[model samples]
Target: MPAPYQPAGVSVGDVPGVAQTAPRPPLREDLNGLRGVAIALVVVFHVWMGRVSGGVDVFLVLTGFFFTASLIRTAQSGGSLNPFTRIGRVLRRLGPPLVLVLVGVAVATALLLPRTRWVDIANQVVSGVFFYANWELAWTSQDYLAADPSVSPLQHLWSVAVQFQFYLVAIVVVFGLAGVLRRSRGVHRASPPPHVYLVLFAGASLVSFVYAADGTSRLQSWNYYDTGARLWEILLGGAVAALFAARHPRPTHERRSSEFRTGRTALAVLGLAAVVACGFLLDGVNEFPGPWALFPVLATIALIAAGPDTSVGHLLRSRFGLWLGSIAFPLYLWHWPLLIFTLAYSGKPSADLATGAAIIAASVVLAMATVRLVEKPLQAPGGSIPRIAITATAAVLAAALVCGSAGWNFYIQRSVSDLQASDELDPFTYPGARELTDGATAPDADVVPALFSAPEDLPVTSVEGCIADFETRDAISCEYGDLSASRTIALAGSSHAEHWVTALDMLGRDRGFRVVTFLKMGCPLTLGTMPMLGESEYPDCLDWTQTVMSEVEQLGPDYVFTTSTRPREGGQGDYTPDFYVNVWNELTSYGIPILAMRDTPWLVKDGVVYRAIDCLADGGSAMSCGMPRGAALDPINPTLASSFRLPTVRPLDLTSALCDGPICPAVVGNVLVYRDEHHLTATYVRTLTSELGREIAASTGWW
Candidate 1:
């Protein structure tokens, strides 16, 4: 969360123990120390507590404050707002450290990470280097704050991305504001200059905050990384900075009284305490970049407003404080990747206390080295750093980083497209689920979705408009498998239901039945408050479910296909919940028969969930990479245990087709079982065509 987009004049002396002749303006050292403290919270909480520490929010505030204040001061001093100069200054300062991190991460990714993760990491590196990582993550809905997500080393760069984007907008705003101010200077002699800019920023902040507050509850994962949602935090910081710079030092002639100093100290103490306490008190992942973010924003403002005379400043200006601030940015860059790589190496989700300590220590050392080798060289006087030349050099580095990954991704896109187009697997080579269900054997062959091609391997429902996204209630439908066939099977539910559509589609085509998909991303027609796919606000999900069910009922399909039972949370058993039964009973009341299958196993080990391809690329054997069958499913089918099983609500569990007698391997019969944590790959699902076909005929007699 710590970003290096600081005020341009941060000299070598600002780093701890470095000597300088020129003294700093007020609060610079204090803000720097705050940066250090924020990064400390981020690293410690990320490595050990596995929770957001509100430190990223703090960085957002500081970054806005520093950049805006610096820009204004430049304007006040009659410096030109030349776009090239502004860009050059930012690039010259930021480019080296960023490139260094990218290059290092690229090398580490190739050497240390599984090949299944390489393309993703490459995407991350390119996005991080180009300063759009936040948007990339937002669009993908990568749960940034999940306890054990597919951890990326560059994930923290989202803050940097947001900040960099803010800088670009701020530059354009400043240019426009300067022209307006120059024209109105004499006309507005009665009023202060900052009021216009304040109104502008305040308006923008209010609009952004409104959108963020509404968005956070509906689609929190996207809202978390959305620049529009997050811009208010940075804008408010800029607003505060503008007010301070225009107002200038509050009459330096005034003496500091003892009571005033005590109040300032109390205020500073309270602010610091509030900032540190925020993460422990609030769920930052779900509640942040919204109204709750004000806690940290106000807390940071309080820290800045406390003034240099307070003991807080005395403390921040101390040796250790400066040292911490010096390495904050690099420490943030190093820590997450180290923590993730450590987890991958150990095959554990969280780090032990000893591992946490070592990661922190190594990060600090690397941060220090970066400061000396990269940052210090850029700042050193004799480096003769030509701003434009370095900007061009940095631009070249960024372009190279982008193109390298882009080329690889281009090849992947072309290759994956061809593979998808020619997707029929030879039954003898890729038996997949058939091996589990029918003891099908195949000639020895590699996995159908090669490690590089596996991540993109997904079901037919992946196409846009096939299913409603988490934020929308539109009953988006897509038809597959003999669209003209008279007998229709309505596929309704969440992605768990969607994954099975591939097999159903294959069955529908071969057997002259139509498959109509009415799906939502994570909503599985639950009417009660229970966690599904780690999401929230079931009201919206409930609404979407009702809409989809109504659409299916109106269509009056011969049978409705959905997932009947889910693997119970925090246990080694799958079960039909009262919520799912609510949906089933409702459908049955309308005289529609339900053909529901048991959910697939979510492969987890040592607290780390395994995506099938990643497991294989991590050097895990097919048998070894899988969870035991007993770990995810009950001895007796849990649907049979459900008290609400109406006779019309037929349960068609195919656990045998998804798992072997004792185990569900990540790979089966030379094909990857899952594309991600639990979604069956289209490649794998295709292999289940015969198995699903036979089951459907027995359940609905449609075949």
Candidate 2:
């Protein structure tokens, strides 16, 4: 349908035949077909795994071979590779279709997505337009792909970026190397042999491949989208092209070279097997572009080396292959965003079988339609449009992508401003007050012991020097509730307990106990110092908590409440028992009665923060947004419950206050509970006061 890829060989009289032992064959349809198959495989794999297709490696090898051959042949014939002409050619090949897809995505995003999603989409649009999305995604991949909900539409550009980077370097280096060689005594010969360039490029590519194989940890850093890790793939193809060019014509019926001959069936089976293995055997989490990646890369090398006259190449170059290959670019571009949008709309993963199938079907149809209607018609010869007109059209599309993304971002921001101002928009209001009193209800998981060795029961630590007074970071003034208040209730722990002040203050008002709070964010009353959020240096939260513990010991509160251990470095954040046991033992030595509240559900849908409004906008009821009691807390942290049996450490659940049955309402008892994704709102804390007011009285044994 399109310009038919211009067929792949140098025309007659384009280059002189070197002193070759064999004739070079014509451009193989089988090889082009193989390219189509490779692109299809990539599309299918990405739709299913949200990962790269091993087939892309195959495409890279083919690109390398074609580009390298062209460069080497021109160099050997004493033709300088004009940089502007080369860049113009590449831009003509890749730029038009890419611009169309990007602008289309921008228009679609503006029409469909909500305000919360626009900021990220706008950032992606800018990076994608400039071809730097690889760096953006590489940073995002650090947390775990499984946790991420939505993948960017332009994520596939990482490879394109890598290829572009390689081409820029290769053009300069190849031309520069030719100049330097011509000046040397060894190179004054009229034409330098093409193998010299091929051998050197191949050698560099191989070295990089070997480096990638040996040190894969770097893949997550720079190697993932780096040209070095990928150079060998292109170099392998280039080597083949160089070999083909330095050949003689064979008499009509005879095969000219031993390397060009192959059993068609064997090549087909071998290539197919290699492709399947890459898809099934490789995992998403492993450092990609690492040693394990050689399976796909080398398999592609094998396929390309087999040649199109062979049975494998012939099959690949069939009508089916050609059609698919022709549409591959558009298909690859459209598939990811379609899948991403589907998953984002559903508020879940599309990894299941049914959804995956649907994604594949939709992607293929869209690719075919776009290729036939837009790409082929516009790019086709004799279309009657001038080159200037075509260039103007491209400019218009580029401008639309920029303006559309900006306009949508502005619209979403305006909506947020307007909504925040309206009294009727109370449904969207984050209940900061209610969240303050609901302390232990926030969901947090425990730190893994392999990353952090939590301390155990100390030998009857005395109260003498243990009690140390410290100034607070926030100016929370200590006021006398009542001079006659004999009973002191200490809230000594992390923000888990600090958030409960609204309820505690109410209890102090209704009951006779004085509420004293000694808490900091994320410290969680742990005995040892661990890495804190944001700050790279070891957080002083533990040191600050130690000071609070000492002062609480001197105050001698009747009841001391703390929370479960949350995430530390190296392990996922989930509640565990060892963390609670460590804290309980430290406070128990001071002869203070302890009350441990189970943490609430940390609502992270698809590794991204989800607000109640996100769910409501998507047609999900407010209750569907919250995690159930059984889902959030695990009876008690497993490590603590298994080893220690403390009578004072009572497990208190206000789950009924947050959820009913398995349905945890985003708004609890008509009050919004959480302010941010995990933490409770200050306003929500006041509402919990009535519910916990009586519970504390009963639990403290001070009725």
Candidate 3:
């Protein structure tokens, strides 16, 4: 990404009108070839396979290799150590393509995405332009519930951000060392030997490796997007670069014997095979940046070492390889947005082979066009962007993106806040679920959570440390609703159960019962092993469930209000898992009566999961965006077939209040039923207060 390896002005023995610059290392054809292959893998796998290829790691290594070598050469020459000149050159090389892509993403987002996603994409743009995309992604991706069709199209810039940050740090460190040497050695020898940098980078790599290994073991989801966890891969490349700089390599390989050439070729072939197989052989998303990442890292190093002697050498120097290398940086920037837009346009979860191929073809065409229109002219010697102009343009683009994104982000956040505050100003105007349970009538009115605010219409536990996130083992609890009342009712389980708090709060306050919550995101209140969160084993969830059960036991609430069952995954009808039954049985043994509520129907159509807010934005009616009852629940309750028949386990189902006839609508009585997919919105849950109160009273005889 560092200026796409700009051709040096006036190489040795070439007659040129340009002034000669400091000597640089000969272009490694093998490295260029490897870059081409890596980019192809990145695109093909992402579009067609739905799997991660370690191509980004390959780029990180190459960035470290090329940048470190260049830094050392500059330092050794006692060159002007001003960092701005160098950074400006890099901007001139990288700025145009980056600005064009950001503009493209902005246009696509405005045209295709729902209002619910506008704030999210704008925040992403602001983060992306300022070169902190990795950190932004880590923060936004923390919630399991938030991962949905709303994935940011600008997400691929995380690698560019990491590399840019490294450039800044690497420049300071290398130049600082050079300055110290100049003072000590009287400016004649301004830099240490290459071995000194080799050792320093090696030490940094080891430290980064330890951090990465520990982080991956602890929480791969967060670590995957962490720059600290990914630094070693790039630093290791710097170590290799320094080692090679110390032992200068020949530009030509003909001086070596035929036997040596054959051996080198064999090693290069083996290394290339490893790079090609790395993604398929290992689960990169779950296991990478850990020790397993060594596979692709070492393979890239091998290609760099092998030089240009084999068929790999010829292929790399070929016209196709050069073309691929020329467009690699822009191609990486272009492919991801194209893929996401394709999915949105088709309204499908993923692209089929034909569709994926078409996307790839489109990406290549766009990449070639970008290289011709945006990259080449600016990077050419006599182009408009002399160093200062490039730097200024980059600053302007970054400011414009930040300003535009902030405008949209502020507008959406304020709008959501206002909607939340006024959602209950007049209950009669938005009667919500009361229209079903109490025959309450009201004039037609707008939904409680307006389309733009729906994504923020979450229950109280979604924030403020009220519930444990997916990563923790701590059983965080909060007291809500009639805290001073003698009788206590515990709300326990995942967000589904946590969402009932709004209604339970009203019931508890009016009926004189305290409501205590035992909640965790995505963790159901069950004795069985919780489902794996993403790809890694969820041992944290396992430990968390036990901690929550113990807390519930100690509280000894009059009745434990919790979700009773889930809609069976990948099949028809709902059923209670044995783990759920075991938890119910154990609570009964503790003399705690159980008020088990059936879960709501998921908003799915055919095989694709759809968000109701997205449907509403696309002009679908409330009932049209809803799910059919038979698709999620049986005609008779599925809980009856389970252990809920036990006297201590009283099943509570209010599907009647949530549904009308056979359909479960996204909005009920002018209130949005769900904030996301299945979790009931706090506003809608509040509307169900009267109906839920009756159920709790009958179950506990508290009334």
Tens-place lDDT per residue, model 2, 1-703, is: 4223532111111222233222324665665666677777776776676555577777777776666665665555556546666555555445566676777676666666554455666766666665666666554442224323445556676666666656666567666666667767454323457667667777887798787654354233345555666666766666666666655545644454444364534656687688766767776335556667767767766676565666666667778877776776677777777776677656676457788788888888877776665555444443456544555676677677778778766765565444334322132233322333343342332211100010110101111122112213331214223335778777666556666765676667677667666655445666654533332222355566666677777888887866654532233344554545776777789888677665656665544555553454445554677755555545545435623577666555565566555655655534455644566654455556666765565666667
Report clashes for each candidate as comma-separated counts.
0, 39, 0
User: What is the lDDT, from 0 to 100, of the residue 501 in candidate 3?
Assistant: 88
User: Residue-wise lDDT of candidate 1 within 1-703, one digit each (tens)?
Assistant: 5424232222211221223222334447887888889889999889899888999888888887877776665545445556566765666666677777787778777777787787888898888877899988877677876445367878878887888888888777865577567667743212236666677777898899999999876778888899999999989888887777656565544436667778889999989898899889988877888799999989998998886667887787677888888888888878887787777677677888998899899989988997776665565443466534544566787788888899888877886887687777788888788787888897788777876777677787885458888877878889998989999889988889988887888788889988898888888877655544454454568778778878877998888888888877777778888888888788888888888788988888755676777778877888887879888888877776543448777678777887776988878888888878888878888888888878878877765
Q: Which model scores highest in TM-score?
A: 1
Reference-based TM-score, model 3: 0.91
Tens-digit lDDT string for candidate 3 (163-240): 888878777878778888888878744688889999998899899899988877767777888888888988888898
The TM-score measured for candidate 2 stands at 0.64
Order of candidate numbers by TM-score, starting with the best: 1, 3, 2
Give the root-mean-square deviation of each candidate in angstroms: 4.3, 11.4, 4.0
Summing lDDT over every window of 10 consecutive residues in candidate 3, give the lowest-scoring window: 7-16
- Estimate candidate 3's alpha-carbon lDDT, on a 0 to 1 scale: 0.78
**Clash tally for model 2:** 39
In model 3, residue pairs whose N, Cα or C atoms come closer than 3 Å (at least 3 residues apart or on different chains), thus clashing, are none
The better candidate by TM-score, 1 or 2, is 1
